[model samples]
Target: MKEFLGTLGQTTARAYGEDLIDFSRWFEESDGIELVAGLVTTLDLRDYLSHMLTVRGLKPSTINRRLAAIRAWLQWAKRKGAINDLPVFPRHLSEPKRAPKSLDRVEEARFLRSVAREGNVRDNAAIGLMLYAGLRVSEAVSTKPSDIEIGERKGKVIVRNGKGMKRREVPINADGRGMIGPWLAKANSDYLFPGSVGGHLSPRTIQELIKKYAYQAQLDPNSVTPHVLRHTFATKILRSGVDIVTVAALLGHSRIDTTAIYTQPSWRDLERAVDGREGGNGE
Candidate 1:
């Protein structure tokens, strides 16, 4: 598996490595099942999927990803004559149709106020990038001083470690400038958000800090995550008449189909649409 993964890109390799490691651990612990590919059957794969869904409580997307990774490994092993009989891959579970989580205007205002009051320079800057620039947490943390170009009038965030290793520059708006400016002035390390011990801030640390800020803002901590901030950024801009292509570019999405998910109307939006059409005194 490692050898097969080695031929892939860094991001893909790392994800497959983690997925294989998890599968190995589960295989070791599961009763009456050895880790050998030849010994595993289609039923065993189904059981593994069941374990992921029931025991691990993984979401459909995550479960599908794990299954895909394992299937790839099994296919490679079979082709290499390592395993004569390969188990059938488990069918992917259908993802539920649900609207993406995003902050409403009121919640966004409250969140901004909370950050101003309770957050430090780095906290403000990190939130700014994800909320305004549509950056992933990993992209924000891995950003270096050289990756940013902030001027008085305009600025851009040079995303180096974006998803799928795709690099892009995201323009920063007025709000982003205000938040990142103070942080940049005080930064002494190579990274934008330096860690206490050494490298850039870990994603887990950022998650915890966001949770703290959410509590301070009187918002639901579970709903306010870095990705939710990104969603909020995209949804707000899209609502304000930004073209989907531009939004997709800013968000570093390779496919417009992926970005189209944000086009789904919120319940509040649907309510407004219906309210606008209601008869009003017969004009």
Candidate 2:
């Protein structure tokens, strides 16, 4: 299965294929069914969900994506007549109730400084995009040299296969573009951050790099993941008074509501509200 996924040659496929294999192993271990017979029913789907939730203790979002991959695989198998019955599916919840994690300006600075000392161009660029551009780690690593247009005044990054497979182009200012100089110069291959085998960087390796830098910066490495870098970018921009709509588009979010979740109220916001309440006017 991994070999088949390797043919796809995209990071997203790699993750999905592994998830499918994991699901099959989980089902076999839990239900004693080495062979998933034809025509899976809704019951089987529900049972799998129950196991993931109760036994594995997976969070709602992770569990949902894994189940989705399983369901899609089953549907394809059924079409191929690999299974007689369709696997049963479980009811999906509306959303995960967890808040997204972000870093403050001080922590963000420390993280970037730590990575600068790592002395790996690809690693710095891959992590920098998350901190500056609010890119998902996958999006940053998969970024192609072609997708970036660094300019004197403004720059842009094209992100393919973002959340829900959406594509969006985001503007980068001088600071953000400056961070990529070494990465672009050192990047000889197509991908901005090529893996040991070429193509996109390994997601696992990037996670490890994040952990290492977090420790050096004297921060909680457990809390300092790639997503935290992305969150820091979004929160910093929003608090700096960038409009929510523009932030949403830059983050490749499909909905403004999703972007709204990242918005942080700045000190100025509180001061403004209080000033208005007290009827303060220009002296």
Model 2 residue runs over 4 Å out of place are 1-99, 264-283
Per-candidate TM vs. native?
0.64, 0.59
| Candidate 1 Cα RMSD (Å) | 9.8
lDDT of 1 by residue, 55-116 (tens): 88999999899889888888888898989877777777997554488999999999889989
Q: Which stretches of candidate 1 lie over 4 Å from their true place?
A: 1-98, 271-283
Estimate candidate 1's alpha-carbon lDDT, on a 0 to 1 scale.
Answer: 0.88
The clash numbers for all candidates, in the given order, read 0, 14
TM-score of candidate 2 relative to the true fold = 0.59
